[model samples]
Structure formats: structure tokens, C-alpha cells
Target chain A: MWMIDLRGIIPAATVVGCILLIWTLAVIPMNAHLAADMAARGDVVVTPHSPQDRKAMTGVTIAVKNPVIIAMTYSLDRPRLPSPHQVAVEMHNTIFTVAPTSRRSLVHHAWVTLSATLLGFVIGTTLGVLLAVGIVYNRTMDKSVMPWAITSQTIPILALAPMIIVMLGAIGIQGLLPKSIISAYLSFFPVVVGMVKGLRSPDAMQLDLLRTYNANAPQGFWKLRLPASMPYLFTSLKIGISAALVGAIVGELPTGARAGFGARMLVGDQYGQPMVTWAALFGAAITAALLVGLISFIERRTLNRMGMGAA
Target chain B: MTPATITARNLDLTFETNDGPVHALKDVSLDINKGDFVSFIGPSGCGKTTFLRCIAGLEQPTSGDISVNGMTPDAARMARAYGYVFQAAGLYPWRTIGGNIRLPLEIMGFSKAEMADRVAHVMDLVDLNGFEKKFPWQLSGGMQQRASIARALAFDADILLMDEPFGALDEIVRDHLNEQLLKLWARTEKTIGFVTHSIPEAVYLSTKIVVMSPRPGRITDIIESPLPRDRPLNIRDSAEFINIAHRVRDGLRSGHVDD
Candidate 1:
């Protein structure tokens, strides 16, 4: 009756195999066609052409066949979208030759945004937890603080970005701090709401047990309420980290800054280079995924240690 | 000699709902001697739970006083004199059986060595020694209740207040727990004040039965069990036990409430 768990290695190996098979099928004919087109355009002249070359060209053409051409025709017959091989080359150059500190490479911008995103997420989550605790414990705080938090999100980040930038400049606080503050502001509400619900989710019987033990306010909070909120806190934190990244990017939008992922997107927009903008976006997405994945891993381990591990 | 553990003097409790005030308990009085096994049997909404809450210091008696060993229940609780078992198992789903048992002791700042020894002792006492690492959700309902009982026993409290401890279980499981509870009681001599709705349970497990009725919830009858002190599972089928059960039923059906 024992079932084998194939979560980690087996699925990964299967995906890799599928990817390799698709790659092989996609690239060989594409390489042959591109080589023929280059020769026709006089980009490369192969001297002393023989029957072997002609046979090789026919084999590649026949393998691609009529269906591939029909598919290409339906796709508007534009220049072929860059294949996996081309993307790999671009990725390699971006990582190595492109200056790590330069706005030309996505890695540089990703690092710039990542540090600020993490800092803002930590600050926001801490603030959110504190606020949630206050709101849960005191009616006045719930009435006063919760409404303002909800209203804060009513103004879109796009509209708010310039105003935030301008206000920070007026206060003589510019650069990283302004961006981090925006990130924190955007990230706090979800954590507050999620944690408040979780902390209060304990059933009546459980609360009664704690009361019967003569647990005071602090004891009950530490021993029962806080532990109950851990799952909620971690889930909201994952969402908050991504929101903080969005905030950091949005924070860079109105500024004439020389760094960060959003700054690169701005530079790309000014220069009319869509590839560079897309690359920077991909970099930011990967950074956010990695950060959230790391937090989720830690959460799972902590929960496992607490005997609340996944079923 | 041991002390007179718990005493309630004309205790009354009222809940202030938005609709109006709901009188939960009216002029209830009782005394529990040290190491005695007492059961409070009553119908639904009969303030049996409210009385237990007053003794546990979770709720205050509105117009009277309750004391445990000559001090207020709250004071005695701070001194770590009592353990409470609710109707639901009340074991934290996030903690292991061992961890749940260690919780109250941990809060009270017991040493690590002492905590471990007490945990082991209680687990063995409740026949859950190997289940220390299992979560409450992983165990059966019967086992979860036993673990909760073990948690109460872990702190070595002088008094145990149980509100409908076996009310949720099947007859087989309930009988099993009752026998084990008797053994634990015999071994530790911890005074127990149990609340239940079952007449047979009251007769089987109690030294003193306090029968109660609804509508302002007053004590109707108090009967001393005539069965021998050392009870096993076989005792439940005995003529003496049936006589006590019938007596308890009579008390319940008599519809007499002395307010």
C-alpha cells in the first residue's frame, strides 16, 4: 500500500527530457535554413560547392516539409522569433561582457532592485504585524488605522509615483529611502489583514483552554495567538515581497535615476529598444520568484518543525 | 491531612447580552474535599459549565465567592494548583502530543529536565508513551482526549476540573477512558470536579453526584455513590451501579429545583 513520492527529481528529469527533445527538433532545420539564406544574400560564400552540400540542403528542406511552411505563413511570415540558441547566447553575453554596474545588463538592475525590495518587504511586514496586533487588541486603533490603510490603495501607484517622488524631494529624502518607503506602503495592508484573521482564527474552545490555564494577555498572545498566525504571516509575506518589488519599480518610474530595473526600462523606452526593456522585466520577475521561493522554503521548514507539516 | 480543595458559596453568574441580561447560574453552592471524585450531572443549559468556569477562574461569579484551598480560584491558579479539561479535546493542532503536554509547564517556567520527566510520566500514565510526536489531528478522537487529559496531568496539579470530558465519545471509548481515569485518580489522588449529561457516567465515575436542572439552573439532588472505591470496567454492569444509575435518573426526572 506504499506510494512512491516523485515530487523532486522525477518530474524535473521529465521536463528536462521534453525540453531537449523540442530543442533538437526545432533548431536543426532552422540552422540549415538560416545558413542557406545567408549564402543567398552573399553573407557567406562556400567555395567549391559539391553534391554533398546539395543533398544536405534537400534533406533539411524536406524534413521541415509543407506543414512547417504553412504554420510560418499563418504567423505572418516575419523574421523568425529568436530561438533558444539565440536566447542562450544573449543571456551569456548579458551576464559576462555587459558591465555588472551598467544599465545595459539586466543583472545590474536586478541586484539594484532586489536589495531595496527585500529591505522594504521586511519593514512593511514588521509594520503590518504591529498594526494588526494593535487593531486586533484595541477598538480605537481598528477604527482609526484600518480605514486609512484601505484608502491608501485607492490612488493608483502610477498616479501616486510622481507625487511620492516630489514629496520625498521636498523633505530632502531622495534615492533608495523614498523607493523603499513606497514599497513598504504598498506591502503592509495585505499582511495586516491576513495576520489579523489568522491570529483571531482560534476556536472558542481553544481560547477557553488558554483562559483556564490562567494565561495572562502576554502569555496567551505568545503561546497561542502568534503561533496561530504563522501560516498567515508567511503567505501574506510572499505576496508582500512581490508587491514591494512592484513598488520599487514604480518608485523608479518618475525619477531621473541612473540605476534599477525600472530605470533600465525607462532608458529602453527613450531609446526605442524593446528587447532591453523585456530583458530587464524578465530579470525583475526572476528576482521576485527567487526571493518568494526562498521565504516559502523557510516557512515550510519552520512549520514542519512545529509539527504542522503538510499532509 | 489534605485540604478542603474547592468551596463555592451561593455563587451566581449573569451574562450581559445586547438583548438583555441572561442569568446563567442562580445561588449555586458546593464544596469539594481534597482527592475526591465529584461529578456534576445536569440537563442542557443547566449552568454546569458556568460553575466549572467559575471554579477555573475563567469566569467570575456575579454575586458570590469561590475559593480553592482557602484562596480565590484565580490566586490558586497563579500558584499552579489546578488543571482543566474542556469538553473538546483542546489540544493545539500545531503541536505534538509531547509539546502540548509541556505547554502549561513551559509557561509556568519549569526546568527542562523536570518538564521532560513530567511529560514522560504523564504520557505513560495515559498509555500514550509512544505517541509523543504525533499531532492531535493524526490521532483518533479518543486518543486526542486522552492526550489532553495527559496534558492536564503533566503539571501535577492538586485539582482537575473536567467539563464533559467523555461526553463526545462512543460508549466503548467512554468506558475505556472512565476506567483509565479511575486508575489515574487512584494513583495520583488528584481531586476531580467533572461535569456531564450522562446519568450512567455520573454514577460510574463519581463519589458525589450533583444533579442540576435548567431555567435559572439550580441543584436538584446530591447523591453519594454506593459502589466500592476501586472500580473497573466490569463494575458498570453490576447491580449496585445500576441502582445508582436509576437513582440519578430519578433525580433528573423528578423536576425538582431548589432555587
Candidate 2:
């Protein structure tokens, strides 16, 4: 009932419309040079006669002299910057025309990346929660484990990804597990940090009230700390799930992944297929949105039932 | 005399702060009889709360002997001999009114039927019979505090220690809750140690009022009420009640002179 406000929707639609307009206008200039060259090769009269001289001219300057080629820019076989329509068509073909199980299918690749992301996310969340519990309850773990967990994130994931892949591959543990570990490594930090803060959110009065009941440690945790941590847990899960998806994609980059969104991005870029890469990138973004959206949906229902719903 | 439900002897508590030793309580002693409503009336930092915490085993007296029901405070705590109500309701936001009351029973290992029965009984007692499905945030401040009282009463502890449970409410709400609390005490006949900073509140509710002061929190005077057990709100205008309230005010003023 709350989300369908026309006020918010209209402004959002305007912003997206602005972006698409800007992108379409930009495409003419970006692909103009290629379009001009294609036209010249077709024995069409071009303003800048020599191919060498054409390289010196800006795409905007070249396209002005050959206005007929503006349409050509929007329909290149492999333009430098593909028009938005080209990308949309590519995405549509891969997502709809191809069989879901086929190698050419974007659905197959999305599912491959999604499976690893979900596995790693569950693993990371469980690990994160366990660590947060230890940090909150044990003085030694708080002092020792938290510092190490923070420090681990400082190492650049790009630099670390190759090393992780090679090390695991050396032991003959290749593919999904390696990708998942990378995902787990990336996702666990937020969950650990958020959960620790949440578990400690209870005031002295709340704790003392429980003490009056002589509640045991497990009872205190299950009854008080766990329930208190729900908001924080969901916030971290949103962040962690996105991070896990990034980790899975990055995990694919190092191993020449045979099938996945990351694999498509890598293969497309290397093979001079920018349309393929653009489609894959959008697919990953949509996947991230869906994952985060699902969490947000669940969060709203849960908090409303708990009466902690945001005003 | 009824058997003493709680006893404190020569109690002294000194907190060592950066500045120096801050005496929160000094040479404090008191006895709470079964079925008594004893109110500790004092200003802030008077250790009325600290003293109550001692009885509940939430705080350790630096030097003193305190017992609950002839057993050590710690032992009594493990036996769940008391229900403590704090200044704030402190109800878990996620729990409905009924669930919050059921929490203690669940922790104490009551059966499903017993938990439900006890929750319903206390909810009815607190006049919150229809608020079972309502969460704490949905209730008024007074209603929330009432639910908290019901929570404490649910486990049927021998003693209820309240530390200014209605201090945050307006006078009108406070008055209504005070009358309800008196009725609750009379019905349950449980020993209650209430801490408040209000003179009239102490006078109106307590069977015995222990007036105190801060800076080295200690009791100044203990007044045993001669008024009848059954009290109406207008009983505050009664000569005996006014006389007791006057004495409590005098005790409070004299204690403050030590500053």
C-alpha cells in the first residue's frame, strides 16, 4: 500500500527518461567514425576523402558532413559504443530466443552465477553471525577476531582473487567452491559488523530486567539478543548479498569461467563483442536488484509484524 | 509480626571513580515484612535504586549483609524469588503484550498451558485483557508500564521491586497507576520495595515510607502508616495521611541539610 506512490514513480520515470535520452544522443557521436568508415568502404562519397585524414576528424565533425551515415552509426555490426537499442536487442535475443539450458542463453549464465552467489551468501552469513556472537559474548574473540576480520578486507580483491584461484586450483579444488569462498570472504564482513552492533543494542535496563528472571546465557541470547538483531541482520544481508554477487563475478574472472555472467563479460570483451558484455553487465545488475529487492520485501513484512515498521 | 521477606544490615557501598570514592550508600539498614508495601522516598543519587538493586542481586554492596527470604541475595536470585520493574517498561518491541508477559514463564520452563494461563491471568489483572495481540509500540506509555508490571507479576514471585516505574508518566496517569498498583498489592499480598522521588506518591502507596537523602545515601526516618489498608485516591486529604506525608517531607528536608 505504501510503495505505489505516484509522486515517487513520476520523478523516477523522469530521471530514467533523461538518462536514456542522454545515452542515445551520445551514441551518435561515439559510433559516428565507425559508421562513416563503413559508408566510405561501401563506395559512398565521404567528406574527408582520405582514410588517414578521417582519423584526425572528430566523430561529430565527420557525421555532420555525412548526415545519412547517422542511421548507419546506430546499426553497426560491431560499433565502438553500441547504441542502446543494439544492447537491448542483444539482451532480448540471449534472454528469450535461446533455450534456457543452451550455451548461448543468458538465463543459463545468470543461474550459474546465482547458485554460487546464494551458496556463498548462506555460508558467509552463518560464519558472520557465529563470529559476531563470539565477539559480543567473549572478550578474547572481540579483541582478537575483529581486528583480523577488518584487516582482511583491506587487501584488494582483484589482486587477491587470482592468488586464491591459483592456490585452490593447485590442490585440485577448482570451479564453484573457489568462487563461493571468494563470495563468502567478501560478504562476511558486513554481517559480522552489523550483527555485533545489533546484539549489543539492548540497554542496561533491558539486560537487568532479564537478570531479574535469572535468565541463562542461551535464554538471554535467544529471547533478547537474537530478536534485537533482526533489523541489523537484514541491513547487512542486503549489503552482503550484493557483495557476494560481486565476489562470484570476480571469482569467475580469474579462472576463465566457462559459463556465468562473469564469463560472458570476460569472453565478450576479449572477443571484441561489446554488445555481449553490455547485456551481461545489465543482467548482473538486474540480478543484484532482484536479490536486494527480495530481502527488502521480507524485511518490511517482518518488521511490520514486530511493530518496528518505519514511519 | 509477619516474617521478614528481605533484610539489609549495616549496608555500605562506595564507588571508586576518577575523582574519588563516591559513596552511593552508607550505613543503610532496613527490613521488609511479607505483604508490606515499602516505599523508599528520596532525591536523585540517594541510592534508593542501588539499594533495590542490592535486594534483587543486580548490585553488590561494597560492605554489607543483605538477604532475601533468609537466603543470600545471589541464592535467592537463582531461585527467582523476585520480579524487578525498572523505570522504563523495557518491553521487547518484537513481542506482543501477552508475549512479553509470557517471556519469564518461558525462561522458567513453564508448560505451554501454564504459560498461556499465567499470561492471560496477569493480562487480565493489569486490565490489559484485549491488548494481548498488540505490540509494545502500539500501547500508550501508561499501558506499556502496566504491561511491564503484568510481566513481573506473571511469574508470581514472592517480592516485586519497582524503581520508579511511573516516574515518566504525567501526574494524572501516575495517579491512576498508583491506585491500580495499590489494589494489585492488596490482592497479591506480596512484599514490594518501591523507589520513588515523590513525597505524595510515597505517602499514598507505601504502608511504610523510608525517607532518604543523597551524597552518602542513608535513611533519615522510617514512617509506619497508621491509616487503614484500603485507600481511596481522596485518602491523601485525610488528616492521618497528610500528617504522614508532612513527616516524610520533614525527614527529607533534614537529610538534605547534610549537604
Candidate 3:
């Protein structure tokens, strides 16, 4: 088990390391102009050498030969692209340095987003399951509702997010509710598709066995369809939770909200502090990974208990 | 004379597919007496399974009359008068042997204690007593099939409809299971309608052998076995059994010729 875990971790760590290396390397060139200006203004003195010496250097050679200028790019107050360490430090400060209840803390913002995500996930799962059941049992629903459900996903979430927030706000509903509604909208599709396939997974022979017992629709659903759908449902829930997090973050974007990761991103963008936005983005990513991990853990335990053996 | 547990008169079943209407069963007729072990032997697509399905009310005949225990097949199904076993074990993988056996009893609203008792009784009949806790995947294919049979017998139905239940097992397993099944039939005395393609198996287990032909499946011959009720494994070596097996083979050949 340890070997298997190490095998999985090695590849993942390599990919993350590569991404960080590239990001760190790119930041120096991307923020070179800003760093040069900061040096000229004398607000930041990167080196003892005059601005004229730095001006003499050009492009790749300047980045390679001048360690001070490269160092300057790593510590800029308002960088075009924040260095990996800058984002990590900002994330650490916002997440751990302050009280969790503080508006400025990423922990508090994540909590606000997480609450909306959880609510939306529950609502979406319920709706998706119900629709799937209806589609499986009723031919008309399968024919009509399935097409609409597929088409509904074709509409871009970015285009729909503001409209939903505005319309819901017009009805005097605001904040978490609108964001949750959007989350529900985004997350439910996977559940519906997965559930429909799962519910119908039992073959004709199994169905015939149930028929021989004279099992009714409700009995069939409860005993056979529902249990059969479990693996599929869990798979979809993993996808759904991640989508719900995305929805919660995007839902925050249109509202100009005062809390949540999306709000933090907006404030950072407006204030020209890329570190704040990158920190919030990382926080959302970590939250999504955690949610998916939690679902997978539950799935393993449930499927294993049901004799499905880690599927 | 024992009353007919299952009676089908000129039954016909045609499945409507996109390609065309496929005739699965045509003019198939048989009478299964109470406590009788009847085996339907035929090639693939011979509608022997369709006939068994008709008896179990899993399939509806396009025309003609079929009855189980003097009532319509559908009514008998609703009354839980029969248990149908499929070609495959069809045991739900998620359920343990005990759980699978208890499924029918649960559906029929048997009390918890009663369900447990019935499950235990059937498991013992199938010689799967200690295997109650094992899931279908944990068991051998033959064992899984036995558990499926145990599941069917749990509700104490008067008739057991089996569609090639041992078709997938190896020769040794099939022979062993065939003997066990004969013992089960003797102990339970439930009228059984079994579908198979093996002539020796038909001769060894059945009170009656039904030879059928395909391409619009029709019964070619129905041979009443002269074998004794109590059959031992060595009975397959007897002249009487060989003679009966030969007759079944001839009937099967005639079925093919007619086709």
C-alpha cells in the first residue's frame, strides 16, 4: 500500500513541481518592467548599481546575469504575475495569521463559499436524482427531459451567472441563496446523467428475476435500482462537488460580494494585487481537491461495504 | 393423478424488434405435473427458455392459454407460486447469500424471524448452510448458482422454473450440481421446469424430457423417463439411462431435421 501510494504521489508531485518552477521562472520576466520602474522611483533599491547599469542589460541576459533584478521581481508589491512564494505567503497570512472570523482572512471567505457550495450540492443532488428516477421510469421524461437537461448545460455559466443573480436579487433574494442556486444549476447535470445510467445498469436477467418475485416499481427501485445506482451516484457526486465549488466561486464574481473567494479575487483585481487573487484561487483549488477526496473516501468505504470492492 | 402444476396449450410468443417480428415460440404445449422434474432440451434459440419464462410469467404468450396451479400465469406470479432462476445465477453482487435468499421473503412481507428460518432451510437444502455470509463474487460459479436456487426456494414456492441454470459450469461441477439439484427436487417436491441442452442431464434428472427445435421454436417430442425417483450418481452408467439418453438424442436430431 505504501509503495502504491508513493507511486501515485511521485507523478503528482512532479507535475506540481514543474508548474511551480515554470510560474517562478516566468514571473521574473513578466514583472521586469515594473521592477525596473520601482528601482527608478527609489521606493525599492534592488541593487547598489545605478539604474543606467540595469538599463544597459537587455531581456534574457538581464534576467540571467542580474540576480538583484530577479530578486526584485519576486518581492514586488503590485506584480503582473505573482511569484509562487508570494502567493503562498499571502495565502498563509490570510488563512492563518488572522482570526478565522475576520473578513480579510481566506479561511473566513472559504467558509462563506463552502456553505453555499454544500447547500447547492444537496439541492442539486436531490433534483438530479429525482429527474433521473423520473427519466428511467417514464418514457416521456426520458425522451423530453433528457434532451433539455443536455441542452441546459450548453449555455455558458458565465453568461447565465449575472442574469440569475440579478433576477434573484430583483425578488429581494441575495447573497448565499443566489450563489447556491447557481451551484445547484451547475452540479445537477452530472448527477442526472450518472444516475440515469446507473439506475438502468441492471441487465434484463436481473430485471426478470425481480419480475418473477412480482416486485413492484417502488420495491425494484429501493432494492435493485437504488443500490445499483450507488457507485455511479458517488462518482457523479465527486464531479458535482467540484462543479459546485466552481459555481460558488463564479456566483461570487457577478454579485460584487463582500465575502468568499470570488469576492477576494475581485478585490485583488481592482486593487492590482495579483498575490491576493492567486492566493484565493489556490484556496478554491485546495477546497475542491479536499471535497473530491472526502467523497472518494466515502465512496471507497460504502462500495467496499456493499461488496463492490473499491469500485 | 397429480394435478397439472403448469399447463400451456398452443402457446406462441413473437418478439417485435426493429428489424422484424422474431418468432421465439410457436405452438409450444406442455403439462407439468405437481412434484415433477421436467427438463426441456434443445439447441440455442430453441425457445425452451421462452417456454420456462412463460411458465414463470416472465414472458407473455402472444396467443393461446397458459396456466400455473389452475390460475393464469400472471395471477400465479402475483401469488408468488413460482420462483424463476435465470441462465446466469443473477445473484445481486451487493447482497450476501443470506440477503439474496431473504429478498423474495422480504418482498412477500414475511416476518423477520420467518424470513431467517426460511433462508436457513433453503440454504441447508442447497448444501450452502455456512456460506450464508459470503457474497456471490466470493463463491465459486456453481456455489453462486446454488445460492440463486436457495434464493428461489426461500419463499417456498410450489414451482421452480430454471432456465439453463448450470449451462455455464464445467462438466465436473455440472454433474455434481445436477446430482445436488435432483436431491433438492426430491426433498422439496416442488414442480420444476428446467431448460437444458444436454441429453444425459435431461435423462438423469427429469421425470419428463422435452426435445425442442428452433427457427420458430416448437416441441418435437416429450419423453416420459422410466428412471426411478431415487437416482444415484452411478445411475448414469446404467443401460436404462443410456437408452433414455439415446432416445433424447434421437429426438433432438429429428428436431434439427424438421427445422
- TM-scores of the models, in the order given: 0.83, 0.97, 0.95
What DockQ score does model 3 reach against the true complex?
A: 0.82
lDDT of 1 by residue, A195-248 (tens): 899889888888877766667889888889999888888899899999999999
Candidates arranged by lDDT, highest first:
2, 3, 1
**How big is the positional error of residue B47 in model 2, measured in Å on the Cα after superposition?**
0.9
* Residues B101-194, model 2: lDDT tens digits: 9999999999999999999999888899999999888899999999999999999998999999999999999999999998998889889999
List model 3 lDDT by residue over B128-226, tens digit each.
989888888889999999999988888888899888899999999999999999988888888998899888888899999999988888898999999
Tens digit per residue, CA lDDT, model 3, A1-311: 22468778999999999998998889988877667767658765544356676666654555665456777888999998988888889998998899999988999999999999999999999999999999999999999999999999999999999999999999999978999999999999999999999999999988988888899999999999999999999999999999999999999998899999999999999998888999999999999999999998888888888989734
Q: Runs in model 2 with CA error above 4 Å?
A: A64-66
Model 1 chain A: weakest 10-residue lDDT segment is A70-79
lDDT for position A295 in model 3: 97
lDDT of model 2, residue B136: 88
Sort by DockQ, top down from the best? 2, 3, 1
Error of 1 at A172 (Å): 3.6
Q: Please give, for residues B100-120, the per-residue lDDT of candidate 1 as tens digits.
A: 999988887899999999999
Which residue pairs come into collision in candidate 1?
A: none
Model 2 TM: 0.97
Say which prediction, candidate 1 or candidate 2, comes out ahead on lDDT: 2
